[model samples]
Target: MSIPFLAGAVSKLFLQFGCSEVRVEGLPAFVERLKGDRGVLTIANHISVVDEPTMWGVLPISTFYDQRTVRWTLGASDMMFNNTFDSWFFTKGQIIETFRGKGIYQKAIDTARAKLDEGRWIHIFPEGKIKQDTLTELRRFKWGVSRMLMESKGGRGEEAPLIIPIWIKGFEEVMNEEREFPRFLPRTGKKVTVIIGEPINDAIEPLLAEYQRKFPHPWVPITYGRDVQEDLKEEPPQLAEMRSKIAEAMRQELMKLGQRVPEVEAREPTKIEWNW
Candidate 1:
């Protein structure tokens, strides 16, 4: 069986056992807005490890715009691409393994650009890492998305990619990073809600301007690294400034989209124990 079909099948099974109900809002309108051969970039918040499979189950699999629009997503190389089975499964799901610390991330970006050139949808989690807090609390976004947008504009000009913001809720409740198996028979069935916001082609400028107004600084362009605990003391000032600005912009936009859903009381923290 093909990888996509396998993934779809597994996702469907998970939906049956893991999720009690799936609610998708604003998908029809977002799908209707897709036109021509323009590239689409979908951004969403990361809450749980099962978020990807949940998305695969809920989103329209093969019927986007009456054509099979290819989908591509980014996965951590060390986390998802190290084992043979994992590599195969993720690859079949169109996930491109990306090495976080290595300079190889540029390769992933190039691959994504190539796919976008072919009018495919690229999905990314701008938060870099999943948030362990409440559903309403969004972590700061990474600068990689802004860099992707800038690169796409430079390459595609007027046909630059369309950015779609999506907010997902309830995946964390089903299975968080701390759990290997989901609670199949919880008191309340798992319910996941996905809300897609309007598309925006001209987001960078406004987002950046708002970020600057909120946090004034003399900015410069810098490569934003993935690790939140990294010491920036040794980095060049300009690069650090630039990366911070871009990350701030992306975070603001995501926060705006996240506000569409009402905040819920913080779920009990997940406890993890390492056996090593």
Candidate 2:
């Protein structure tokens, strides 16, 4: 399948913006992994806006094209969603919004199921927001990812979409600010690296057991009026500790599958948590 002309055009935009080389490797393995008639759900670390595009450049556009897997993206904010000029790449990449109201949660569930059925490649940041002023700790993984996967497994009766965790390094420097506004600053001498991890099954028995031991109750009929921020704040310290474990597991897995990065100068963050 020939790449859409826009792909090449977009490739140059990254180059023109001080992206010296968008290096791509492990494509053969990734292509082979996808050729088996399975959709993919990539959970990528959201550091900078450049993170996804760099991964897009490294990925085989032709394979993703043939699969008809629209690269779905979940933005961290309304502003991030609204400011995006590129909607041609995602199924509904505009805003990662979910409808609210009476009995509407099921609709959101159904939307996730339908996306998988369409054989689309969905991208989510498990953190749900970018980590600014902190690099050492990953925010807890939102239950939405686990919920979507569990629902998909039960609905399809086949292996769910291949879950790929991508660890992106160096974008924090390139974009270097909490929000998007600071990203456009004059380009400094910085480089970025994106490491793609191998796929995993979200419904694995061990993972479910792990969740049970941690969250205890899987489903509850809670009212909608409660603030979600308060709910998230209620998470136990165990959850945060467990989250770091999961993120490190994924990071290590990514490092194993990715290339040995060349020795490059990295701008260490003020606060750093070494994953290795």
Candidate 3:
């Protein structure tokens, strides 16, 4: 009745070396929901390049044995796929490369959409990049996440993905972007905490319903350089506006969980409370 010893040795190793005290809340529900055959979208605040993997330390080591419980995440092509060795490693890690400036209509997103259609779990750092100022504010989320969230329906009778928001505290101290020399090694003895939200499917369903009501058409993928950079020039006005709103809404949702982070960082986490 036990999971294999080496199931999550990698995350266990990090948990041993990276932080001193680690506390997590609401993960059991997150893990349980993944058992169903529905697309799952999980979003988290990105404090460092390794936050996603590093934060995995909290999951029960046995959780790694079941592919159903794992998540597929997007990685920056420029950094994660810089070389053949790096590309091969990231690919095996269940990460897909997303170009920084490219629009949401790229191959990586297409792959993510395809995976979601297959009922796979897709995690995204909607901020699109690492933000060192997580204690003060979270940068605005990019539209790519919204595109994945809304267009996932594809008018194919596939159910929309279940949405989950997570907030992590303390990765910034482990891998400070400004650290000098021996950058590859993570700083030790830091305190870390993770809070997972229950499914916010109800809140997102309204937006998806509104989006579907407005579009009522199949999605077609396209990309134009500057236009993509600007307000998705090729997209319909309603679409462009809605994507921005959905991304912002997710950001705000995580912000609700973030209220406890500052207190945690100051060594005083309050009685945990979140309003979904």
Which candidate comes out best when scored by TM-score?
Answer: 3
Candidate 1 Cα deviation (angstroms), residue 17: 5.5
The parts of candidate 3 lying over 4 Å away from their true place are 1-8, 134-136, 154-158, 219-227, 262-276
Query: In lDDT terms, how accurate is model 2?
Result: 0.51
lDDT of 2 by residue, 41-74 (tens): 7776667655655446454444434535336555
Q: How far in Å is the alpha carbon of 72 misplaced in model 1?
A: 0.7
Which clashing pairs does model 3 show?
none
Model 2 is weakest, by summed lDDT over 10 consecutive residues, at 267-276
Question: Between which residue pairs do clashes occur in model 1?
Answer: 221-239, 222-239
**Candidate 2 Cα RMSD (Å):** 8.2
lDDT of 1: 0.62
By lDDT, who's the top model here? Answer: 3
What's every prediction's RMSD, in angstroms? 8.6, 8.2, 5.0
lDDT of each: 0.62, 0.51, 0.74
lDDT of 1 by residue, 1-276 (tens): 566655655665666555666666676576555544777888889987767755655545443223335467888889888889999888877888787874312567668767776677888888887786876667767656655654454222336667778888887776655664444432237776777887754655554444344435422225443343343554445444655665565566767887866532133222111111
Report the lDDT of model 3 for residue 153: 71
Candidate 3 lDDT over residue span 60-159, tens digit each: 6655666676778888888789999988777877888888777777788778877888898899888877889646478888888887877687323457
Q: How should the candidates be ordered by TM-score, best one leading?
A: 3, 1, 2
